[model samples]
Target: MIEIKNLCHSLGGKLILNDINLTLPEGSIMGLVGINGAGKTTLLRLISGVYSADEGEIFCDGLPIGDEKARERLFFLPDDPYFTGHTTGKALFELYRVFYPDIDRKVFLEYMSEFKLDEKKPIRNFSKGMRRQLYIALALSVKPKYLLLDEAFDGLDPLARLSFKRAINQAAEEYGTTVIISSHSLRELEDFCDSYALIDKMTIASSGDIAERVNRYCKFQLAFFEDFSEQIFFGLPVISLEKTGRFARIVLEGKEDDMKKALEKLSPAIVEQMPMDFEEMFIREVEGRGYKV
Candidate 1:
């Protein structure tokens, strides 16, 4: 498990994150999401010990993250991982083996083959997606207890995305590896992550099971026989509403059954409840905070 308490950090005399507290259980995959410059990377760095916190403590399985033993159990994959011009994928594996002595050579080779990467070739010759595949192979070989990934799906084709997701799921199921993945790809995250944390305004705006969080908001498309004003949903826990002539699309926050009944009372010619996906939930969340999404 990972626990962070009273976490605060600053850079160049400007506060980036403050009073942040989070707990992640073992063997679960979590999606870390936020807009640009929301300190998502900073928080991940703090957890991985790349940057020391100005205040508060971070623990991995009861040991401080600064502890070498704790650090050994954690692997952090930054958005832009570093590789020199002459660094070959095979050479990278050897280097990682020095630090992670338990790194599985066979597993690494297997994944490399699956990804169709030439480990003997210089990493600089590989495209962005290929490099990412190489590093993911390395990560799987390391088999750390906790894996931190930033922009995990940035440069992958659809096939590679499938392979990546498959590998991550396999790691979690077989090795009990806990993962925190930061990404702008909410749809993909929604498909795999069991839970999510939303970082906004310098802190965690929301975090919970993906299904439960999405269930809180209900969406509906309604068509009326005659013109009607938006005020019809003024007191119905409306999160967002769009009206065009006699057609309207609305999202309400309440029990689904209750919201549906309330809307039914409005007597529309047609009322259809639409499924709300993660992307829609995120848009509504930020929009509720006065963002013009």
Candidate 2:
């Protein structure tokens, strides 16, 4: 497991992250979601030991992250990966092997073949998507204990994204790789992540199993028999509500059975369960945080 306790950091007098605390266990895929300047990248950098934690302790499997050996078990792929001007994909693998002595050359070659990425061309000439693929290949080849990826799904089409996510799941199941990926795509994140953590205002706003958090709220649509005061439904246990003519769509903060019982008492003409997607929940959570969602 990885533990980040009271993590804090700043750059040039600007607070990039503050008092961030998180616990990530092994053998799980976590989605790190946040807005552009919410410090998702900064938190990943701190956990990977690229940027030192200004205040707090970072531990990996009971080993202090300050030790070089502990850091060796972690791999971080930034938004824009750095490589030598003329370095080829094959050469990149060799360079990585110098640091990650147990690099899986076979796996690297297999990924290259799967992605159809050329290994002899200069990295400088590779397209943005191609470079992203190469970085993914390298990250998997190293087989680190913990993997951190920033904007991992950028520069990829739908087919490629599907293939990438499938490969990640395969690797996690087969090799027990603890992976944390940061992405703006909620739909994509929802597909692969079993757990999640949200960052807002330099602090962790929420974190937990994705399914559990989503289960806490229920959505319903009701068409009243006649014109009635909309305030009748207010504060019954609602996260938010929208009204259209006689129909009202609401998100209730409780279980399906209890909510159903309560709504039955209202005796609406048409009552049905409404769909609640993750984006809507995210908006509500952020709004409660006093921000414009």
Candidate 3:
């Protein structure tokens, strides 16, 4: 497990993150979500030891995050990973092998083939998406206990995104790799992440199981033959409500069964429940905290 306690950071005399605490377990994929410039990448960099914390500390397993042994068990892939000019994919692999002596050349070759990349070709000539794929393959070959990826799905088509997700899952299941991926795509994160952390106000505002958080509030669409006042649902734990004539869509905070039973008491002509996904939950959460998206 990774433990962060009272972590703080600053750059150019401006505070980026403050008093942040987090616990990430082994073998689970976590999604880091936030608005642009919310310090999501900065937090990831701190955990990876690229930027030292100005206060508190980070522990990987049991060692301090900056320790060589602790660092050896993790790999950090930045938003823009570096590759020298005219560097071939094979040369990249060789360079990585220096840091990760156990780098699996066979697995690397297999991934290159699967992604239809030529190892002999210079990475400078590769497209943005192609370079992303190559780096992902290298990360897998390193087989670290923990993996950190920033903007992991930036330059890819739908097919490539699917492939990347599959590869990440495979790594977690097969090698117990603990992965933390930062992305703006909530839909993509919802597809695979077991949990999420939301960054706001220069700190980790919230974090929890993805399913439980999204399911806490139930949404419903209601249509009544007779008119009804919007005040009817005021007594209930309504998060948000919108109405059009006799048709009203409401989001209430409660379990599905209980909320449905409560809405049924109103005896509406039509009552249909709508599923709330991660994106909606995120928007509501941040808005509740007075952060405009």
Candidate 4:
């Protein structure tokens, strides 16, 4: 488990992270969402012990964050990973072996072969996509209990992303590893994350089960048999409404059953559920907060 209590941090003179409190239980996968410069990267740094917190403390399985024991159980991969020019993929594995102690040489070799990554060649010569693949492969090989990934999918192609998701899901399912992944790609995060946290204005704006949060927002597409006064349904429990010549599209907040029965009296042509994907959910959420998702 990861525990962050009253965590605060600053840089130069400005606050980077406020009194943040977050707890991630073991064997859970969490997606972290935030706009650019909204303390996403800095928060990850603080958690990984790259920077010390100005106030409060962070712990992993009751082990102090950044302590030697905590460091042994954590693997944090940044958006921009640094690799020396002369290091090969094999050399990287050897380096991790010395530090991680549990690095799996066989798994690393298998990944290098599976990804078609040349272990003999210097890592500096690899493309951005290849470098990302290398880090992901290496991180998995270490088999850490807590994994922190920042923008893990930034440079991958579709096939690579599919492979990455498959690997992540397998890790969560098999070994009970708790993963905290930060990304701007809500559409992608929605595919695998069971829950998410939205950080805004230097704080956690919202955090909860993805399904529960999405279900709170109800969307409907209404079609009328005849010209019914659209204003008749006005002032209902709704967050937004859209009107065309004959049909009205609306979003409400409540149970679909109660809503369906309530609209039965209208006798509309069609009242159906509007499909909402992860991207749509995030867009509406940020838009509701007066920001672009």
Q: Which candidate comes out best when scored by TM-score? A: 1
TM-score ranking, high to low: 1, 3, 2, 4
lDDT of each: 0.95, 0.87, 0.92, 0.84
Clashes (backbone N, CA, C under 3 Å), per candidate, total: 0, 0, 0, 0
Task: Determine the backbone clash count of candidate 1.
Answer: 0
List ranges where model 3 is wrong by over 4 Å: 226-228
| Candidate number with the higher lDDT (1 or 4) | 1
lDDT of 2 at 237: 87
Tens digit of per-residue lDDT, candidate 2, span 6-39: 9899988899888988999898899998777999
> Lowest-lDDT window of 10 residues in candidate 2?
275-284
lDDT of 1 by residue, 105-193 (tens): 99999999999999999999999999999999999999999999999999999999999999999999999999999999999999889
Clashes of 3: 0
* Model 4, residue pairs in steric clash: none
Give the backbone clash total of model 4: 0
Model 3, position 91, has a per-residue lDDT of 93
Question: What does candidate 3's lDDT look like per residue over 1-293, in tens digits?
Answer: 99999998998999999899999999889999998999999998999999999999999999999899999999988888888898999999989999899999999999999899999999999999999999999999999899999999999778889989999999999999999999989999999999999999999999989999999988999999978899888689887788999999888888999999999999999889999999988987877788754
Candidate 4 lDDT: 0.84
